[model samples]
Target: MLVTFDYFLKNLDLSNKNCLDVITQGQWLNVHPAALVFAAALAQKVGKENVIIDNTAGKSGLYIDRMGLYDWSKTESPYHYSRHEEAGRFVPVKQILTSNDQSKFITDLIPLLHLPPEKSQVIYYIMGELIRNVLEHSMSKDGAFVAAQYRPKSNVLSFGVCDTGVGLKKSLSYYHFPKDDVEALKLALMPGISGTSMSQSGTGDNAGAGLYIVKNLSKMTRNYFVIYSGTAMYKLLKYDKRIERPKIHSDPLDDRHSLVDKLPDFHGTLVGVDIALDDTSDFNALMEDIKVSYSKALRERKERRYKKVKFI
Candidate 1:
């Protein structure tokens, strides 16, 4: 059976079944990233040995080989380089990272990817913040899973982070209640929505700026930024040209930007980013732009609140 969202939901209750068959012999199983995350989490929950691939001699085998799916030797790294080899280019790898081992993982990845110092810093910041989010908010005992691939010819870098934990809706519900998954995702991306409650002194994730900053950076680089949690999915496509700030569209029908609802629900959250290696965006300037935009948004929200109060 193909490992799709439906398959995941169906197999979630792994009770009497000893081995959950993911793929048949010689059949190519197309697995979505979110499905991969779900499978990994399930495997950890049940015995990894209990998840079986019926046929291991075809495309499915090669896929497993490329991803190091079943390899669990402590001496072997969870990261797997792509089987397709290109001369003088880095082999894209899917790596599993834990909060405890992130530093070493980043250190090993930096040199292999051959990223410029500035670009490396950007990746570091993005990955660090996302991993931190998983550690702090995900509540997943198994930690986070990440995958990255860079096509040198196209100069496109694609990476994703996934965690099977309390999804965005549940996490944000601890702060402000959301009517649905879509609203919860929107609120999570806002500048000051966080599960972390304020202290007596009123200092906390006052900026709640992690996702906000990541979104701005993606826009500045004219890259793709996608987030999926629960049944909602949000995507920001790369713009044709640079803009001071990109508009966020909440309508799912918007082709340029997508905010979709009613997707098959995943157990946790997944964030995917795609950037061009030749992107010339200045990191500091992008950060400043985010701050300005956020400040403007805060002012507008306060003004609306004040106007409502006056009308009442």
Candidate 2:
């Protein structure tokens, strides 16, 4: 289990350091987009450069100790049932990428999925377009990406992406029509509107097609997308039960309340997404951990295995 706010309290100063980033599934689910903007901005203001973050060992600050500490001999990943002796429901998953490569990797994320090649590739392209907004725009120095899949006897896999970078408010303002975190979110869903006029950093999506495509795909595929920034938040769900009706605050306002007016007091951006997968015979097995272009995380993992440590 995750430690109490004690981690937050003890690392209050480190929050600016980007030293502690942890949250429950519910917490991540309920994260206010404004917080995403704030955290990314604040992390930047405090000079939180990308420190070596590793999730393979569940070493990322957000993982529970139980989800973390592991015996070396138990080498098989718990994600595989054959290796399931005793473990928690979570593990650390990490990635480090340069801005440009991260953008490319976004496009690459799709083929790794079990979905049909066409769906996965197009999804990667769409995701790539959305991520282009982040890597090209969010403006934070460091970032992190995590993905996990669970088979509750259902035909689906869940995944998410998070980062500490320039948030939607700043990026939105970059285009033109600015709004607070909440309003910007609504604006994102609207077509033919964007924060930018012709800026390259943003997806430059005035037609609102990029976001709309994501929203539409989420509905068609029965996937879910939760977007947050600058305290403005929105969620689109496509389950069999009931499709979510668009909120009344649909037409997003201008950048009057965007999060960038005060640079030093803000945190970076964070995006969480989930797509569905058909239930196969073994939906529980994960073929791989996140595969980013960066190799440093892998090199570090190999190095750690050789470091002989003596238990007291």
Candidate 3:
């Protein structure tokens, strides 16, 4: 029988160790940006001196090298190629440790993709939120590892961001008590739910809508967005394009998604998103829609809370 994505996720192990050992299947192998960043984040945790790759036996291995994963590990690249030639093709594995580095990386990223202002806006919105979450919340000293790849054939842009720090359950422990990683993920994706503060309207700086907005944006564009942390993974399945306007759900479980638990425990967080450029909507208009939706969701949630009161 064929296995689901959850099956693989359940099998993925990233335990704390003094060294990192990477082994990939031979023959055909497809590597997603999420996996790449996850591996990079693990390597950063163990130090490059303790990282090793057991095999580099096929075109897949060469692609890994091209993605600059070798630089993160102690393994030497078996193939030699000009680094300049790889430019503009993809954002290789990059480590961003501070806000300044994040800003500079975003600025330099646009030209390489050669995207027009409108298209680049989506990238900026997605990336800005993804990186900022790691910087402010993850509490990982190593920070975030991010990467991107644009496939010309499909016209889809893929992004991955990962951090080796306290996962969602721990992050939400301050104000919310989630039974497990999956429950924490649900709260994390809800608008106005932030670990930084107990207020629904997050501290002046954070509205707690980063992940919610990004996932909703992916749904609006009929794309895929995945968030994995603490042995649980929640995937926003691609929306049906046939629907003229898909209803936005305040509760993530109401949307088309897959939630699986009991996976190998990962100490941090990992996110993977794919955006179809052709389906991307106007950035400003989309943001406005998200704002309205967020407000409605928050209002409804509050109403539900009020209804639970005993008004005798």
Clashing pairs in 3: none
The better candidate by lDDT, 1 or 2, is 1
Regions of candidate 2 where Cα sits further than 4 Å from its true position: 1-119, 143-152, 198-208, 238-266, 278-312
Give one digit per residue, the lDDT tens place, for model 3 in 16-42.
Answer: 578887777675444677878888999
The list of candidate 3 runs beyond 4 A from truth reads 1-8, 307-312
Q: Enumerate residue pairs that collide in model 1.
A: 25-55
**Ranking according to TM-score, highest score first:** 3, 1, 2
Report the C-alpha displacement of residue 114, candidate 3, in angstroms: 2.2
Candidate 2, residues 220-293, lDDT tens digits: the string is 44555555454444555345545332221222232111122212322444454454444122221211111121
Q: Please name the candidate that would achieve the greatest TM-score relative to the true structure.
A: 3
Candidate 1 lDDT at 137 equals: 81
TM-score of each: 0.74, 0.51, 0.94
